[model samples]
Target: MEHAIIIVVILTGLGAVFGLILAYANKKLALEVNPLIHVVEDVLPKGQCGACGFAGCMAYAEAVVTRPEVAPNLCIPGKDPVAKMVAELTGKAAEAVEPRIAQVRCAGSNEKATRGFKYAGVSDCVAANLMFGGDKTCKYGCLGLGTCASNCPFDAISMSEAGLPVIDPEKCTGCGKCETVCPKKVIAMMPLTARVRVNCNSRDKGQVARKACSSACIACTLCVRECPYQAVKVENNLAVVDPSVCVANNCTDAKCLAKCPTKAIRPAVLGIVPGAEDQAAVERACPSCIKTNTAAG
Candidate 1:
């Protein structure tokens, strides 16, 4: 009993000494963190979307505060308002952040796209893609499994009734999370001002692409011939639109939209139908086209 008591007292003394030593060492060896980092982080949107090229919001705050070269407008989701705040806080010149939105490049809804077989395995797109490039006949098209919708951090993407993902432009922060998570690479980031887009991703030959998905771009080149500004072209059996050329030429007539045989080229804005008689729909789809038509009339 006496020996046990002595042993306990020795252990207690050793623990007390080690505790004191660790506390002192921690204080002496600790690196002083800049309070400005916390201040910057607090001002951030706290989305942790990595739109700023950092791992998260806190990492971005640290980089922008510590590094002189990191730009204040790197936060894409925050847009101009957040850029202004970040610039004011860091004393950096604020650059305008061009707003962008996520666009699903595929128009292959379940009704339009033919299925190779029924998918019976995992719900994840990555897992499904490993099994014969998913059940879709068009390997490059969306799987309609809600992978992009599930992975989107902003909740801007939702699975439509047609078994395809629909993006809400207002809710999308252009974080590129959906684009990254898409196994088929059908999701992409587009400029918010974009007036038109090619809604197909399949590079299969015209007949094969049509067999797979009725709405697939057949690479017919009709759009190419119809476009007056040389903004559309056929590349790798797929129609590609040069938005820069379209913007520079102010080619808002959307001739490509009218000429696409499969309706592969579509208005960038969702819920707007091309050639619809509704004036509001026409304006929403292509405002500049309406203005030009009105002037001509």
Candidate 2:
């Protein structure tokens, strides 16, 4: 009994000594965090959505405090409002942060796209993509599985009936969360002031694209021809909008909107609601699916 008691006493003494050493070591090795980091962080939204390309608000705050060129206004979700707040806290000028929104480039819905097969697996876009690209015949269309909608922290993206994401600009703070979750990379971030966007992301040839999805851009170059400001450009067999010039163009005559066979070119000013339906019937249902399918064939 005496031996056991002595052993216990020794162990307790050793533990106490180790504890003291650990405390001293921690005090010596601890990182000196700036008091201003907390101040800057307090002003941040703490969404940690990585809109600023930092791991979190704390990371951005660290960079802002330590570095000079790391602008405090890179936070997209925070927008200009947060940028100004951060700048005030860090004693820096707030850079101009143009508000941006997430856009779904794919118009290929179940109604608009021809499916090669039916998906019956994990029911997620990530999983569906592993098994031969996706269920949709179009190699570059949304899987309509709502992975993006599910991952969105602000509930900005919602799945429509025909299998496409509908972005609520009001809810979306341009967090870029939806853009990251999308496996197809069909989503893009454009300036809120942008008045036009190419709704299609397909890089396939015209005939090949038509067989996969009816709404796929055929690379017709009509938009390039119609734009008065020289804003539109045909690249990679797809039309792309130069956001810099596009936001300033007066091309809202509905000319490009009309000439687009697939209605892929939507005016950003009119606040185009990206839908699964065709350009005209996008707001409603297809007036010519059954009868028209028979007539066309």
Candidate 3:
């Protein structure tokens, strides 16, 4: 018992010595984090969405402070406010970055998309996609099982009763989490200032696509012919919108909306809601007055 006590005492003394050494080493040898990096990180949204090409907000902040070439305006979700704040903290000039928001490319809600079969398996989209490309008749359609919502670090996405994920533009930082998590690649980032979008991702032929979903783009090239500035084109059995072309030409006529037989093209204004009385007028004119009331409704 006496020997054991002595051994315990020696061990206690050694442990105390080692602990002191470690604490001192930690204070002396540890790399001091820059105060500006912390300030920069605090200004960021901490979404970890990888829009800044870094692992997370902290990683981006460190890079911005340490690297001379890393730009301050890389944070897509933070937009101008955060960019300016980060730039001020880092003593750098903030470059203008176009703000963006997540958009559901597919208009195939549960009510719209035809179901091949009831999905009885796991809830994960990636897991569901592995089994015969999910339950939707449109293979490229969203699984609508909340994978994107689940993966989103920010609470910007919610599963709608229509069996589609609805994004809140106000909450959305355009972190691209929903875009990355979507197995069908049906989610995309669009400029926040966008006024028009083709809300379909199906590459199936017109007949097959129309049969699968009422709102599917038939890829009839009507949009291509109607776009005066050639901003809209039918490619890979889908309608793609080129913002640069549209913006450069100041093409606000939106002839593509009227030309789209399936009514696949939609006004993409972020927050505005179109009333029922204006729906028909919007259908005819395709003006900035009508927003994407489909998803919000």
Candidate 4:
């Protein structure tokens, strides 16, 4: 009993001494956390979507608190209200940033697009795309295996019955999570104010594109010729719309939508159809091109 008591006493004394040493080391070695970092983090959406170019919300919070160059309006998911709050927190000017939402660039639905082979591998877009550019004949088309939808922190993306990702504008925080995860690079960050858009991203020639998918952009240059503001261009057998130029000219006319033989050029807003009046203007824009397309059809 005497030996046991002595051992316990010695152990207790050593524990107390070690505790004191640890406390002193902690006080000396602990990194001080800035109070502003917590405040900035609190204001953040906590989505950690990396839209602000940071790894996560906490990282962005630390960066904004420590760095003078970081913009307060970089939080796209937070939008204007959060930007205002961030500006107030950092005592910096909040620049007005136009809102952007994810748009599926490919219109190659299962019904419209031809399949090269069956993809019986992993259900991920990136994984499925490893097998000779996916099952879709259109190499650039979305695999529609829910890789983008699964990665979306905001739950804005959902796979449609047609095997395409449908982004909900209301739920979308513009975080770019879906855009980053898509292996096909079919997802695009489109400005909310964009009036016109090319739904297709196929680089195939007109004939090949039509064979792959009915809605594929043939790079007809009809849109390029029809756009009065010169905001449209055919690059790599694809029609590309310059939203900045169109917005600058206040160009809202859907002239390109009418001229597209494959119905690939469309309004940026989902579910809304362009007016029929634009078709009359397309005939006037390029009569010979329309005549050739009609003859080919």
**Among all candidates shown, the one with the greatest lDDT:** 1
Clashes of each: 0, 1, 0, 0
- Please give, for residues 1-297, the per-residue lDDT of candidate 3 as tens digits: 999999999999999999999999999999978888888888888788898889998999999999989999999988899889888877899989887888888778777789988889988999999999998999998888999989888888888777777888789888888888788998898886665877789999999999999889998998888777878878899999987777777766677776567778877744322111135545545653245344444
Candidate whose TM-score is highest:
1
The weakest ten consecutive residues by lDDT in model 2 span: 281-290
TM-score of each: 0.89, 0.86, 0.88, 0.86
The list of candidate 2 runs beyond 4 A from truth reads 1-7, 269-273, 276-297
Error of 4 at 178 (Å): 0.8
Clash pairs, candidate 2, are 195-268
lDDT of 3 at 173: 86
Compose the digit string of candidate 2's lDDT tens values, residues 1-297. Answer: 999999999999999999999999999999988899888888787777887888988998899977888898987788888889888888889869888889889878778789889889997999999989988888888989999989887888888776788888778888898889889999888887665667788899988888888888999988788666777788889988787775565333434444567667765532233543344442122233334445756
Residue lDDT tens for model 4, 175-251: 88888888888988889888766778788899999899988988879888877788888889999988899779876
Query: In candidate 1, what are the lDDT values of residues 198-243, reduced to their tens digit?
Result: 7889999999999999989999999899788888899999988888
Q: Lowest summed lDDT over 10 consecutive residues: which window, candidate 4? A: 271-280
For candidate 4, what is the TM-score? Answer: 0.86
Question: All candidates' lDDT scores?
Answer: 0.83, 0.78, 0.82, 0.83
Give the total clashing residue pairs for model 2.
1
Report the poorest 10 consecutive residues by lDDT, candidate 3.
269-278
Error of 1 at 251 (Å): 2.7
